[model samples]
Target: MKLFSCPSCDQVVFFENVVCERCNHALGYEPASNAMLALEPTGTAFTSVGRGGDGRQWRYCTNYDHGVCNWVVPGDGAEPFCVACRHNLVVPNLADAANVALWQKMEIAKRRLFYTLLQLNLPLVTRAEDAEGLGFEFLSNDPTSGQHVMTGHDDGLIVIALAEADDAEREKRRTAMGEPYRTLLGHFRHEIGHWYWDRLVRDGGHLDACRAVFGDDTLDYNAALQAHYANGPRPGWQGEYVSTYAGAHPWEDFAETWAHYFHITDTLDTGRAWGFVVNPRVDREDVLTAMINFNVFAPTTTIANISDAWLALAAALNALNRSMGAADPYPFVLSETVLRKLGFIHDLVHGRVN
Candidate 1:
């Protein structure tokens, strides 16, 4: 979420850049340092050409072969994939060209999700490490069998439907679900929230506090969802939930609120990196005066600071999108209840809470 520069040429490159355009140097993201380093070929491995750890040998994640990833693992490490790619349990069948492209798009979003998680210093254990650790299965619908895959989480495995990669298909589902916004990154954030609920709430012994904020998650999830779909959200649901779907269950409320916290922090981090300042000289409102001068990624950042900056930034962004006749980039409102839930997640991630 921060600006990256090519170590070789000092040219600004993006997080997902595989090659530095200015110097043509190969690039790989180092998760430990949270940097996109320029690489120098050194035998079978590549040496980082960056500060602090220059000359460290590394290898691109195996997913890099499919042109889907640019993350690196230490050359001395036994894993063939980087920290991010290792979570992938099943990638789409690459024999199909369309599937290859879909997987690439999904990886882009997944890596971004990993970036934020890593920044938060959240635990990211693989299924190999823990029997129920976080993992992913990128599956596609089988047209021949008329079977469709749903995007959700079970235990710790997050299933991402490959169909979500297609813009038309995703948009259709978004409309059908009555969602204001939905994307591959959103899916990762939402599904991973379920995994975190298990780890941080159930296993981490924060059930009391979590239930207090998110409502009793013990309520029958399926029945709650069935009732919610049969009878839509309560009037003025925005006052209590971030989205209509969030009103379905206490678990869903937590996941939706958790996802929004990630969205707010990561987007605010990006705003800070870009040197964004929402000072709107004409409107002297105190609420619109965020300067985005602090690091949102820092553990010390408070929920108040994040929400304040995010409200101003989201307003500015929404106006920009409206100016161009586009939908609001961020369409959700953060009510006091939602902010309290977000604060709970913020505390949970920072280890301030169980």
Candidate 2:
């Protein structure tokens, strides 16, 4: 995500900031302009108070009252939620304070996912608009069944387990599953990848091309998953898949690779926003050198540029983590085959492929 600034004081802000620390102004993100606005309350609504302010009134999404969202909707608009929050089919029970806190964490990650989707100009339709439109449900374990909510996607609805919000619980599951990296953001990206596959590939006439790259998704999904758990990831998966889980099935490969595509472009965008450049003085071969000067989300941006910059930035990030004794922030390595899968996603999103 790009770094935002408090429009009133030009103080550097962040994606989730609700108030400008420097200017002491209330902040809200306007999705249409992809901008964070500093606001002054005008009755029940707010008026923009900085450069490019048209004095137009804005109102925070209804979810803002719960301290979960900071996106704004036009004051005169009929919609009660912003573009990102409108797709919510269900949310955790806010009556419980513990649930409220967990849901807040979930919303933060979900909004970041929407930021990249919007930047890519991908299609987003609420379930109200279409039966198979993208939607979300934050659920907890069933009280009766005593079964945990599986974090997965069904058709267009994505279910996120509230248990995943707890750092300890998530880390435990990550360890048990032998995943090097797993987080709420990763869950959102991976699950949404399935929805996009339905919309862009299955429905958008790219099935044949996608199959050639991701393999035939028509294979039995349940059987494949059963085999994956029983027998483990396919041998030599590292040479062809982004993650071991990706080798379970063709659909999974697409989703895992799709999430990585988001990971690469979004992280690269952040690197570009901070004016990051990788030029190691000690290295004679310039293979590690990269300048994140181009917009990673642009239609014109090539997968090669993104992959090169990401490799350089990922190295710096991993090194920085090691300096503090933290695990590598990025743990996956992209092979030539994985890069080709990512390229297909890039082209699909940019309308370069049918």
Candidate 3:
């Protein structure tokens, strides 16, 4: 995430900020330009003071009325929702105030996920364009209807359980599942990985290469999952997989690893935006000396280069969290084998098959 500033006062503004605190300029994210613009309402539409000086009027996404989104749709565009919200097919009933609150939280995470996806310049097709293009459904467990919603991806549609938005509920599940970290954004990244696997690996004619790196995805998924839960993760799983859940099947391994790649690169981008640099004055190991001055999302960034900066900064972040009597910000370790898998994903995302 690049650092944002209010065009009115140049005050530092975070991604989720809707109003510039200093100048009180209303703000909205311009999805086309990937910029947070200070808005000037002109008639029924908004004229961005930042990049769209072309007098291209824009309107906030319909969801913005509910305070759920800050993204804007071009005034001339026919879509009611922004690029991110357009993917949502079914949302929890907002009649219940609780559901509204949960949906708000989910939208925040979802927008952040979209920001990263847009930053990576990944293909984001709507279901209207492709039958298997990306879409979302946020549902809740309804006992009366005997409807239970489990968070998972099918085809190109990703369903998220509304309860997952509750931090306490998510933490309970994390503890029960013996997981190190879990978040709404993490869930988005993981499920979207499944969608991309369909688009990029399975259909993109790189299944053979992906199989070599992630193991044969043709293996029986249900059986693999059953054995995984029954026996737990294999011993020394850390060396090969990003998480114990990743070992369930080759598809999962790819998804989990893909999620981590996003985690590392996006977090590294945030660090860079904050002007963070790691040049330890002590020991100064060669691997820890890489500076984070370059654009991490650039296709030229090698996986080895990413790992170098990621490892050093993640260590510092973990230590900072410990100093504050909190859990490590990043609890996973990347072994050489895992790094190789991440390299494959990096290459794949950049459209390099060889």
Candidate 4:
């Protein structure tokens, strides 16, 4: 989650920016270097290489032709597709004008997912097989398309209907799920949790470790899923669970915690870049300890933690929303359990947690 800048102009840029606002420079993110490069097209728009990024070769994704992306593939790559596009098992029809724009929105979120995954040093290796590879299917989600398709995951691939990318549909599902916070990025994080479980939880090595903190993962997933649907999470679920679904199973708890980890790090790193929080140098144990003590054992820490930060951030975010006449950018509060989960994830990623 370290800040990124436009390589050409040195202007700070977000991962989702398609065109630099400061210089009006065409832009594309290079995953290998984890950068947003200012593009200098060397050929025609459709068949051109952008003059910047790692190895000095970059080309826009084919979906860009359909207006669904502006990201570049490695210019020298024979595949002629961006990393994100390279993983597409299927993309819904773009001829229908609505699908083009909707898919673009999905790409924006997906790219953000890639940014965080890359930033965290998470392994996102893609494979052709059903069980080992990470992949995605952006489908129409139309009943007419077929009875086989559903918004779910199989092996390491996540299948999200293009429907979920729509504002109304996403909101409807969020409400139906009764989740205080839910969004495309959240969905990506949660799904990737399943991806990583498969990635690192083999040989029952992680079974005991995961169970120690999140509870047993050995429960029959199908039966647990059924029980969860039938009974829902226990009352006052937040006392011990990061999210209601987290109480369902160990795999779910891991996923829920995993999502919160992405949320906290990206937000914290972003806050630091914006000069909202003082950042410390590497070994950051002081700031880490401060954040932990403040959030987890507040009575013991003198410095402020996320609770205080959230209060200020919430006010500012709400005011910004009010100024724009839009909904608040951040929609939920973080509970204590969620905080501990984040700490766990932070340590695990840094190899501090075993």
lDDT of 3 at 161: 95
Q: Give me the displacement of residue 145 in model 3, in angstroms.
A: 3.4
**Candidate with the greatest lDDT versus the true structure:** 2
Full candidate order by TM-score, most accurate first: 2, 1, 3, 4
**Weakest lDDT window of 10 consecutive positions for candidate 1:** 47-56
State the lDDT of candidate 1 residue by residue for 234-325, as single tens digits.
Answer: 68999999999998998899898888988999899999999999988876667687899998978888999999999899999999999999
Give the alpha carbon lDDT tens digit for every residue of 322-348 in model 3.
999999988999889899999999999
Misplaced by over 4 Å in model 3 are 50-52
Candidate 2 local lDDT, residue 256:
91
Residue-pair clashes per prediction, in order, are 0, 0, 0, 2
Give candidate 1 misplaced runs (Cα > 4 Å). Answer: 50-53
Q: Decide which is better by lDDT, 1 or 3.
A: 1
User: Lowest lDDT 10-mer window, candidate 2?
Assistant: 280-289
Residues 149-242, candidate 4, lDDT per residue (tens digit)? Answer: 5566778779877888888988998899887677888888888888877766543255556567777777899899888889998788777777
Candidate 4: residue 237 lDDT (0-100) = 76
The digit string of per-residue lDDT tens for model 2 on 1-354 reads 899999899999999999999979999999999999999999999999898788999999999999999999999999999999999988998889999999999999999999999999999999999999999999999889898799999999999999999999999999999999999999999999999999999899999999999999989999999999999989999999999999999999999988999998999999999999899998689888999999999888999999999888999899999999999999988899999989999999998885
TM-scores of the models, in the order given: 0.98, 0.99, 0.97, 0.79
Query: Top TM-score: which candidate number?
Result: 2
